[model samples]
Target: MSNDDINARRREQVELNMLTVAAVAGWYIDTYLDKKSCRDSALSGAAYVNELLIGHLERFRQVCRMERPIFMKLCNVIRSKNLLCDTRDITLEEQLIMFLFTIGHNAVNRQVQERFQHSGETISRHFNGVLQAILSLSTQYIRDPSINVPIEIANDTRFYPFFKDCIGAIDGTHIPVFVESHKQAPYRNRHGLLSQNIMAACTFDLKFIHIQAGWEGSASDAIVLRAAEKDGFKVPRGKYYLVDAGYGNTPNYIAPYRGVRYHLREFARGSIGPQDAKELFNLRHSSLRNAIERVFGVIKNRFPILKNTSSHSFDTVTDEDINEPDDDYNTDERRREGNRMREAIANAMCDEYSIHTRRLRDRHGH
Candidate 1:
């Protein structure tokens, strides 16, 4: 159909659906808007959505550098599916919304093609733009400008109560992604599916401070931690991230020992042996570490698409479903092939981290 015809139909559709859209927009504002400062309910909400959506789209273009054709392709799918735009005719506002929706959904070329009947190249173009937007937004949102601690935390918490400076909580999460070829093994998880090992950090307030997506699942949590430590991430000095058993105890990072409950969990469980006092220390570390769990929960909550399997052309999510080989490889050929496949597949993953001291050093400006 001609673009004009599509625009005419979309106008009618928007008119019909406007009330519901406004209601949803209201909810969006209520959930995300700053309540104390935003005095005008209706205007403030609308402005917030507009700024966020526009900023998302603009940022996407900067990061992805997508071409027009690809951008159009992605927009078509988002509009057709009623994702954000809800109309075929793309206004600047609708386009912005589409970009935000695409990033939050992690929708890629093939998925867009399948859902919107657009070509792969178009989706690719648009995908880059959306990716760029995500990168920019993530960087923008993942920082804490005020290095100082807030007053409430100083009184309420024992750790860093005086300075209100807890560096952050760290954790690794698996994101389902697809891969091509036998190289997918490394990304495969214990459940026998392909997945990306993503590592992230959040402030004491449960705000996401740093996110490193695109890691292979085969790598240990320690590995992810080590990698991030090298990345010059803003992990403050004299403060430590709360970590689980996956990481090793270091000056900057603290992890609970294996087989012991953290803090109160351990108190109910048993006293520490003299030989295991250090072990008990580790357990106490975990009690503080659990905060990352809630941060991850909130991230997933904000972006429901993170919970949905990636249905991109790369089928990164599909590879996450691959079955692990039944037996461990004893033969040279089997071992070689397995390791080769793991390395090859690992590169395809977005990233990996291991509990390497060198990597940690690099990340910490050593």
Candidate 2:
């Protein structure tokens, strides 16, 4: 072998050595990446499990806004319905708790991630999954209103007999929303905030009977109602709902007389009772109609997401319905008769009270 053969052999050896070094480096980098990924996954899973186990039952309720039993029941329902299944990394309970935490507190994804010790992506994925699961159970949770008046409401003299024909009360409230620039004008309400006109109806028990949301804030209550009617808002031939002045007194819908004191607070000051026929009618109407307001208050309180405008797509329909009544009754006539009866009763009560007061005064000799 001469000088040329020797040089060629040396070059081949150097090339083989470099290739071997490169192969070893690649294998080390791949192993390090795989190990890091596994460790991260394990830590995330452990963190979520530890957080859930760290708190007492009351603490769970305080954070999740539901009793542990109710939470467990809901979890069982989800599992039974196959709405959500347990995964290797996150269980069904963790997904639900995280989602409830976000809704109950109106927390953002980042907040939920930090609380659960997970990545933003993981938090978002489970949040959306739980939301879809809840929506799927809407039909099961929402009930159809019965024709008979609920015993709880019927027993109350302030509501019964007078509200016998009233299946529920309907009203529109503004919920803050976000919209594109071109669409913002339509959603800007009287308060000059972008919002959605959410019209809802609720029974005496404060359970929602119907909801028509996603309407523009600028839309009038009457217009939205008309749209609802057009879209098959069922009102039995005669049963009606108590509504505010923003609605009209149709054959099946009763609105308080305009220019009359309506809200309960308005009658709280200086007056022992209603002053006139309109006032009497309004007093009764407001008392029954206030159920819907209370329902809204409870819902907003329980789920802060509805209280403020969050960065969510407003196009999604979040309307819910439960306990819808069947068939309509003679609403207009019933309302008129009920008003007269209510007025007569009020006067008689006031007169009786006055007589008792005079007797007491004579006894006291003041």
Task: Choose the strongest candidate by TM-score.
Answer: 2
Clashes (backbone N, CA, C under 3 Å), per candidate, total 27, 12
Model 1 segments beyond 4 Å from truth? 1-89, 99-124, 144-153, 157-165, 263-287, 313-366
Query: What would the TM-score be for candidate 2 when compared with the true structure?
Result: 0.74
Predicted structure 1, TM vs. truth: 0.52
Task: Count clashing residue pairs in model 2.
Answer: 12
For residues 1-366, write the lDDT of model 2, one tens digit per residue. Answer: 999999999999999999999999887766543333323444464465556557687787777888888888998999999999988778888888888888788888667766666666677778888888998886677655677776655887655665576788889989888677887998899989998888887778888877677788898887667666655577765477878887756646777778878888889977667766567668877877888888999888988888888766675434433122332432566557745554554455455556766899999996
TM-score of each: 0.52, 0.74
lDDT minimum window of 10 residues, candidate 1: 345-354
